[model samples]
Target: MHRLANPTRFLRLCNMVKPWAMAITLLCLATGLYFSLFKSPPDYQQSDTVRIMYVHVPAAWMAMFCYSAMALSSAAALIWGHLVAQLIAKATAPIGASFTFLALITGSLWGKPMWGTWWVWDARLTSVLILFFLYLGFIVLHDAFDDTSRGARAASILAVVGAVNVPIIKFSVDWWNTLHQPASVVKLDGPAIHSSMLVPLLLMACGYTGFYLWMLIVRMRAEFNSNKIRAIRIRQANR
Candidate 1:
């Protein structure tokens, strides 16, 4: 982890695996979509519309996963003053927000057909909505200060504080009455979903993960360049 704090080394690592990640990402996506749309059978109750689960569930899971990553990275930044971790938290914000948005949109589309409404104030849905707001709040706070350190610190704190929402989002279905379904794929008990459906769902989840990693590397590179440009400008002004 310490070795990766060096931007050059981190970028080199990213470069080394980037091609493989991209390849795997594309492969998984293609296979996943084929299975999701064609290979896998529809739900007994919901019929063909159940296919939406392939995208909606994974995006929802990734949205929470990304926030957990950001919160952990933010903790590292606050504790060890790891600049790379701070950059990671910063870069992760938008991607997580996008995933959350996708989840919400897809959920609404599915709900409109199944639940007979486009939106609901269900516990799980409501908590996930709060998660989206938390992402935006972190981004806003990160840029609210002129001092870069202050901004990073503020965002780190916010990320840590808001992490409480992650669990709330997860358990909301179990803890309260909700329109959303309970855990099917991940549970202490064996998966409730069929093996055929699970295969495509898992593949799509992996694809989403690969996509996130690939984008993180690209975004981190841009962030490093921006920092260099800012430093050079400061030096010239001082001179």
Candidate 2:
């Protein structure tokens, strides 16, 4: 990680990895979509509506995971003064926000058919909404100050503080009486969902994770290039 901290080294590594990551992301998305749309069996209870889970659940997972990633990167930035860590946190915010939005929209879509309502103030839903706001807040806070480092530091603090919401989002169903269903794919005992459903769900989850990585790498690379161009302009101005 330290070795890759240098911008040049990071760029080199990204160049090497980008093709493979993009390829895998494409493959996973294609396979996952096929499995999700064609192969997966309908839930006994919810029928065709349950199919939305493949997209909704995975987007929800990525939304939380991306924020967690941002929080960890923010922590590293605060402790180690690593610019790459700060850049990663910055790059991840919009992607995570998009995923959160997808989760909410898809969840609402799924809900209307199953729950007869498009929205609810359930604990899990509310907490995830809060998480989405946190992402927006981080992006806003990071750009609020003229001094980039100061803005990054402030955003980092907010990211760390917002970490509290992640677990709440995960356990809200268990911790409170909520309209959201309890854990199905991940549990202490085992996945309660049948294998027919689980396989497509897992594929979708993998696809979403790959998509996140692909976007993150692209965003980070663009950020690095922008910084380089800024540095060159500053040097030219000085001369």
174-200, model 1: which lDDT tens digit per residue? 999999889998899989989999999
- Residue 79, model 1: lDDT of 96
TM agreement with the true structure for every prediction: 0.98, 0.96
For all candidates, what are the clash counts? Answer: 0, 0
| Superposition-based RMSD of candidate 2 using all C-alpha atoms, in angstroms | 1.3
Clashing pairs in 1: none
Highest lDDT scorer: 1
Worst 10 residues of 2 by lDDT: 3-12
